[model samples]
Target: MQKALVSIAVAASLGLGATAAQAAILDDVKAKGYVQCGVTGGVAGFSAPDSSNVWTGIEVDYCRALAAAIFNDADAVRFTSLTSQERFTALSAGEVDVLSRTTTWTMSRDTQLGISFVGTMFYDGQGFMVREEDGIESALDLSGAAICIESGTTTELNAADYFATNGMEFNTVVFVDQDEVVKAYEDGRCDVYTTDSSALASERSKFADPDAHIILPEIISKEPLGPSVRSGDTQWFNIARWTYFALLEAEELGVSSANVDEQLGSDNPAIKRLLGVEGEFGAPLGLDNAWAYQIIKLVGNYAETYERNVGPDTPIGLERGLNALWSDGGIQYAPPIR
Candidate 1:
């Protein structure tokens, strides 16, 4: 009978393609998503708080968007900042509900850390940053340069790998956290600063003289950053995963918070299902059809969030290269929200 209900639901709702399929509102996933990051001060576009004690960033908005999805209220989340060394342990120990700390999803973290990734929210790559006066035009030229990086991160390993593979030797000016890494680099303790290309740009944006530095053009390692939950909780995983994908699908469907009400009357089948207009698509997941609707209406679709928080017009100003929808030139394709 359960199988029959699910099958009927799938058929009736037209397959909720890339949509989050209204997941079950398990208490476990609910508690899991009530997440907090290590520090809200670093990673300008990913997570940071502003002068008014209000938090805002890509990762911050993601949490807000997710909270809206789960509880229908974006502000229903509480946060505690963790450091790089403490984030994973905190998640596993149930210290945070979700880890949206701009963390890279790697095999070790996935299989070994007892955590699971829902999907890739941001596709990035490791790169180097140097002062404009350094005359280091390419990563290939950074022979024997001291590079600043945060420990307890894949960035350290990736930096070593890139330098070794390129037959270049480099010195690592390691720090305990991202803030330390950035400060050490800014103080000229290291000849170069390295992290994801996006992070290099983000860090550079905060510099006293942002134009004094330049991020090299070369990308060293792929960094697929996203949200993570404890491994054993399937319900939480489903909810978080679908909630993220729903953002992408909403963007693809032209659903924006500003226009969501107008779209409630849309005749498009896909739009109807997404906005809770026609089918009970969210029923099986123990959610009302408005799960995605609330997310879209409150936090907006993927592009909207990205453009708002990290787009080219923003301080972080990331280009929608790989993050663009598959329909566009990028690989950011979400499953159909049937």
Candidate 2:
């Protein structure tokens, strides 16, 4: 009886030891020395390769921010281009650390797919783009129009739901990639193209005559596009979430890539906390104290990133309407660094 009891205690200790060995994702990423960021093949304002084959966009910035936080080097990231069909599978199987592509945070994806969307980096909506000659003022006028959209995306289902709910009819020309959809739309094979409003603007700008297209005024669905990770890693989720909020907070506090180094010595308490001066915020995530500072110094704040990539001065020319800070009547809010 004594021998049997001792064996049971030994087995329990082994089980506990095994459980402790499985650390959270943040620790795993730190140990690995770099982050695996999954992104789309190409989307002009969100994720795309330049002439030098360097990826740059809003989504790309998020990946860089994560790397900067973890390794204090924004370039310490390996970007893996993924299609919509492969994104969730890759994330679930741990092929990528985070999916920062323009993936919509939806109920089915969050609860059913075993992934957790950290937070919204870009608050978007589904909209349509039509040729100038089409005279379509709103999505309501798109009835009977042949629409071009990418398959295996939430946009497809949202398009169907919008048409069905409005009692309208239309034919869809589906493709596996945004480039194909854009080609089909530009070739006059489809009357209109439906996608995220940002993407619609991007596709419109690529046209031979940019002025020949107009994005309709109607936004049909809410698309909170953001970063995502596997569901089981709570620590990683918090790290991703706080990193995003830090960007927004930096913007609110007037920190920028151009001036981050100067602002690091400022007297503001909040700034110090965010810059790793007064707090040990990074230690819990297995990162250095100056993690957020590195991100701001290397990647810039959210506003700077937006302006450089997709803001009013760029070809994408997006205004900071809903993406502005909460103090400025936008929904983009961040928690205090304390």
What are the RMSDs of all candidates, in order?
A: 6.6, 3.5
Error at 183, model 2, angstroms? 1.0
Error of 2 at 213 (Å): 1.0
The C-alpha stretches of model 2 lying farther than 4 A from their native spots are: 1-24
Q: List where candidate 1 sits over 4 angstroms from the true fold.
A: 1-25, 28-40
TM per candidate: 0.89, 0.92
Q: What tens digits encode model 1's per-residue C-alpha lDDT throughout 108-172? A: 99999988888888999998899999888999999899999888888899888888999999689
Error of 1 at 313 (Å): 0.6
lDDT of 2 by residue, 219-329 (tens): 989999999988766568878898899899999999888888898899999999999988899887767889899999989999988998889998899998889899998
lDDT for predicted candidate 1 compared with the true structure? 0.82
What RMSD value applies to candidate 1?
6.6
